[model samples]
Target chain A: MPVIEVTNLHKRYGDVVAVDDVSFTVEAGEIFGILGPNGAGKTTTVECVAGLRSPDRGRVSVLGLDPRRDATQLRERVGVQLQESQLPDQLRVGEALELYASFYRDPADPGELIDKLGLGEKRKTPYKKLSGGQKQRLSIALALVGNPEIAILDELTTGLDPQARRDTWALIEQVRDSGVTIVLVTHFMEEAERLCDRLAVIDRGRVVALDSPAGLVSSVAPEQRIRFRPSAPVDDRLFTDLPEVTSVQRTGGQVVVTGTGDVLHAVTSVLARNQIIAADLRLEQSTLDDAFVELTGHRPAE
Target chain B: MHAFGQILKIETRLYLRDFAAPLLTVALPLALLAVFGLIPATREPDPQFGGRSFLEYFAPSLLVITLAMSAVNILPTVLATYRERGVLRRLATTPASPAALLAAQLVIALGTILVSAVLLIAVGRLAFGVPLPRHPLGFALALVLGTAALLALGLLVAAVARTTKAAQGMAVPVFMVAMFFGGVYVPRFLLPDFLVRIGDYTPPGVQALLDAWTADAPQPLHLAIMAVIAVLAGAAAAKLFRWE
Candidate 1:
């Protein structure tokens, strides 16, 4: 069974719609990414799924329990790490994990989780005294301390340096390996591309696209661009006549072939038939950024 | 609930870790008593003070000022900071409700004030030759009512303030007004008649505490005023409290 199901979720605050018709399902043990730019209702959608906010219209199920009706039962099984949440300035690292651990019926060992998160030395340190990376790690530790079956982390790496972000990503994969369904809400295309098994690209409170990172990229722009400097002259019709080749163009002593599946193989074989070597060959594949811009009609501002 | 107790234990420890609020809340009032209590003039009974020692006149008011400091300055600011920092919202994501944290804060604030009151009374009798309240029940009743009224006002401030800095700023006028009219800053016996009249109408004002400590019974009128303030402010606070 899917660990979480959100169907036709709609939520609004006064006149402003925070989420509209947002729907997705998180399977067991998958790192399901909710990819979107800021203010795209990513947090609102997950809030409803976590039972922190009730949807105005929707059906949400987590582990076969209704998020709104079975809220207590749901909370017991779902862990959440919210964006920009803070601890008391004087609360120590171990004390925070212990406090959160006490909230669940059966919780993970606080000491073990803290050590796993690499915070053993800072167990007695106050929250305000920790660096940004340490605080972020502590927040993630609190989420998993409940030993919840599903964990939802929102904006997990928004402000971290590149190295810390990569470290957090590795930790998340380890959590998933231990049997927790992960719902990661993030706007960083690289984070989504690196960690997500399947992504629901939310744009302006709606799901614009849903697929794996590579699948979403290809769905938008499947054609690949192969560039090479040919050893001899070749006719454009030599490659265009093939089914996979869409167009062949020449640019500044180089030939650029644009086509769909197997385009590279078809062009290489044609060059070989003409006894020509394709030098300085390079293939440019479309990234998630390209797909995001194509689907959303603009770049997600970094 | 177990979660409430856990949060309370951690919160109490955290509150003590701070150098300013808790220290000043309990220590400042006791410091005043120690300084004034050591003086012989305040210890001697005199007719100008209605046959009561000058120390007795200020003892109950000292406890009232402690309540004002904690409820107005400390308690509301802590709660507002929790909401400002997203602690309350974060708690909502867990099996524990955020209301657990709010309840724990109230318990800690009241507990601190109660301890302060007890220490002030104990130290005064032991070191300064001051008598404890003659009517224990009346003193307890007035203390409860006064604390409730002040806390309700504090909760109202926390409910409406957007940030911790704003909470402290908004609580200042309430704190100052309580100090001035509650007879903590000036004795009711020494205040002008018009100002005394205003003090009589103030909620958690020290006059009831004074009446209970020195008189046979606390006046029904003072108790009724505090009860009214508690209800009105408490209702407003409950209606306006926000987690974010």
Candidate 2:
């Protein structure tokens, strides 16, 4: 059985439909990404599933329990890390962990979970004293203390530095490896690409695309791009004559070549025959970001 | 039962960390108690009330003040801060119930109020030679009614205040009215007849009813009415409380 199944969820605030007919399933032990820009209903959908909000329309089942009707049971099985949620300023790391753990019937040992999150040395530190990245790690640790079957993380690495972001990604992977189903809400295409098995790209309260990162990118734009700065200006038509090269465009000293199969080999041979030692040469594949912009016609903001 | 205990512990820890507020909670009232209970009573007893010292007349009132401070002044701040900081929202996702949180707050407040009451009573006895209550049952009845009334009033304040700042702002004016008119600052009998009449209609009006309940000569009818008002206010608070 699916660990979480959300069907036709709808929520509106005033005239704004925060979540409009969002439907998805998260399989057990898989990392499911809810990819969307801000105000795209990612957080609302997750909050409804986590029993924080009661949706006006739709059915949500987490571990076969209704999020609203079986709120207590659902909270016990699901762990949630909200985007702007906070602990009290005076609450210490260890105290916060223990207090939350006490709310569960069978909680993970607070000391062990703290150690796992590398917060052992910061146990006595008040929440106000921690850095942003440290606070994020502590929030994740609190979410896991219930020994939950599913974990929902919203904007998991939004404020972290690059190195901290990578460390968080590793921790997420470790959590997934332990057989915990993860529902990651993220706007970062790279995060979705690196971490998710499947993703749903939502826009304006509607899902625009749903597939694996590779599948979505391929489905949107399947061709590969090759670019090189030639020693001398070359005619665009000359590159297009190659068997693998589908199209070519030249502007200034650079040539952009689009190709079908074996494009790299064909382009490199063409370059060699012309005695053109490419100044800046690269082959590129379509990324999730490209698919997102193509689908929504807007670059996602942080 | 275990969950209840855990909630109580968490609430207590949070309260302990707010060192300044609680010290004021305990100290301010005790200072008032010492001033009113000892300073005026040094000379002699009031012959009209059967040779009772002023300290004896006011020690029970200090207990009511302690209860008022805990429920009316302190409880609103605690609830308002939790709501403002999104603590209630966070707890909503946990196994803790709304009812459980309120219950924990009541238990913690009652416990602290009781300790403060004991200290004030001891100080009154040692410093001013105030007599112990002649009727323990009557004093207990008045104490219970006063506590219920203040808890109700505090919860009511929490329901109306949207933010912690608003709650703190509301607490001051409301507390002054409840204290001055409720007969904690000065006994109602000493006020002008019109003001006394108004005080009787307010929470401190109910205090006179409690005072009547625990008076040297007990008054059962007054105690029953005061106790009924306490229950109604508590029910209203519960009905109106918003966990958001």
Candidate 3:
């Protein structure tokens, strides 16, 4: 059974529609991602699943229970790390973990979770004193303290440094491996591509595309590019005549081939036939970043 | 209920760590009492107080001032800061309701004010020879009712103010007005008859109940007015309070 199901959900703030006819299901033990640009209704959708906000129209269920009617029971099973929610500034890391632990019927040992999240050394540090990465890790630790069946993390690594972002991603994989279904809401394409099993690309309060990261990328632009510096000067017609090649360009003594279906194999064989060695060859596949721009008509920030 | 206890424990610890709130809510009241008690003329019985010394006449009002300052000036700011900082929003996602945190804050504030009241009464009896409340039951009822009414008003301020700075700004004028009616700056008996009558209906007017109890002539009318304010303000606060 799916761990969470949101069907035709609609939410609005005054005249502003934050989410419109949004629907998605997160299966058990999968790191399902809600990927979108800022203010794209990603957070609003998750808030409904977390029972933090009731939908204006349509239905939401978690673990087969209605999010609104069974919110108290749902809370016991679903862990949530809200996008901008925070603990008290003076609250120590260990104290925060302990306090949240007390809210659950059977909570995981906070010390163990702290160590797992790499926050053991900062256990006694107050929240305000912790660095951004440490604070994010601590929030993750608190979210996991209840030993929930499903965890909803919103904007999990929004402001973290590159190293911290990668570290958090690895931690998220470990959490998923422990049999917890995770719903990650993020705008970072790299994060969605790396961690999510399947993604729902939300744009302007609607789900524009829903598929695996590679699937989404391939759906928008399946053509791949192969760039290389040929050992000897090569004519563009030699590559253009190939069946798999769509376009060929020569820029400052380097040859670039854009094509689909065995293009790599076709290009290499053609280069070999021409008796020219292709040096510095690299295949650049389309990424979710490109797919996102194609679907949303702009980049995340734009 | 268990959540309430845990929240209260943490909130109390956090409250004590802050130096300013404790100084204003707990220490300042006692310090003021001491400073007023040291005056020779205040130690002598005065005609204005019907043979009671100034220190004796002022003890109950000082307790009211302590509770009023905490409820009006301190509680609203603390709750509003929690909302501003997203603490309440965070708790709303948990099995423990954010209402538990608000309840714990009220418990802690009332507990702190009660402790201050006890200390004031102890000092009044020991150092200044002010008699204890002749009607202890009446004094206790007055204290509880007055605290509830003032805290209700604080909750309304917290509900209306979007930020801690705004809460503090809104609270100051209310605090000054409460002090004026509770006779912190001027004796109640010295006030003109109509003004004194008007003060009798304000939330801090419970000071009249406390004074009557201390003088062994408990007035049912003052207690009735306090109970009415407590219910009305409490209802309004409950209707207005927001988690975010």
Top of the candidates by lDDT = 1
Tens digits of per-residue lDDT for model 1 on B1-244? 9999999999888888886876788898899899998899999998977898888988877887789988988889999999989999999989999999999999988999899989988999899988787888988888999899999999999998999999999999999888888777777778898998888768675777887787767888888888899999999999999999
Better of 1 and 3 by lDDT: 1
CAPRI band of model 1? Answer: high
Compute each candidate's TM-score over C-alphas: 0.96, 0.89, 0.95
C-alpha local distance difference test of each model: 0.90, 0.80, 0.87
Residue A20 lDDT in candidate 3: 88
Clashing pairs in 2: B182-B204, B200-B205
Residue range A1-302, candidate 3, lDDT tens digits: 78888899999999999998898899999999999888999999998999888899999989999988998888889999988777788899999999999999999999999999999999899899998899999888878888999999999998899999999999999999999999999999889999999999998899999999989988897889999999998888888999999999878878889998789999999889989999899999888888999999998762
Proportion of native contacts kept per candidate: 0.90, 0.62, 0.76
Model 1 lDDT per residue over A1-302, tens place: 68888899999999999998988888998999999888899999988888888899989988999888898988888899999999998999999999999999999999999999999999999999998889999999988999999999999998999999999999999999999999999999999999999999999889999999999999997879999998988888898899998988888999999999988898899899899999999998889999999988888768
Off by over 4 Å in 3: B186-195, B206-210
Which pairs of residues collide in candidate 3?
none
lDDT tens string, model 2, A208-234? Answer: 888988999988867789888888766
Residue-pair clashes per candidate, as listed? 0, 2, 0
